[model samples]
Target: MKEFMTNNDYHDIGFNGPNYTWCNNKEGLARIWERLDRIWLNSKSIMDLSNAVVKHLPRISSDHCPILLQIENKKMHNNREIRFKNMWCSYEVAKGIIAKS
Candidate 1:
């Protein structure tokens, strides 16, 4: 898995709200939990989806838990608006610039 991830330039998208995804469904000492489900992304995907995240859902009628991915879909700011601080208005230069712009 390490070699595969390295070779493919893939990285794990870690989860929140759960430590493991799979369970043996046994009682006490016999029970076992493991992170069997995973989500991987390449460098390009990671860069494109900058705010991507994973979430783990509650398991029901199954030993393996479900997984979810949440991503922020913000468009690239090519023409972002300029914001001026309130304190900058105190300066003459800032007042001139603000007036000019």
Candidate 2:
């Protein structure tokens, strides 16, 4: 999983609320808690969605707490607007091609 994430440029977006996401309904020492759920973002998403937030909602019925991703800023930038066509891809080579053109 670490290798895959590294290869794919995936990063975990830390959450707010309860630290432990999973819990075994038990008393005292028998109880078990762990964080098994998470929200991951790719390099592009991390860069484009800078205002995104991950929230860990309260657990009601299930053992795992629900996660929510809220995008505070939908627009990429307020000062300037950049547009891309459907045929254009945002790759390294594509950047060079667009720059050259």
Per-model C-alpha lDDT, please? 0.90, 0.88
Query: Per-residue lDDT for 4-98 in model 2, tens only?
Result: 99998899988899998999988999999999999999989988898889999999999999989998866455676668775676566687778
- Residue 92, candidate 2: alpha-carbon lDDT: 63
Q: Write the per-residue lDDT of candidate 1 for residues 1-101, one digit (tens) a residue.
A: 89989999999977797899999999999999999999999999998988998988999999988898898797777787777789988998889888887
Deviation of model 2 at 81, angstroms? 22
In the predicted model 1, the residue pairs found to clash are: none
lDDT of 2: 0.88
TM-score of 2: 0.69
Angstrom error of the Cα, residue 3, model 2: value is: 1.2
Candidate 2 has which clashing residue pairs, if any? none
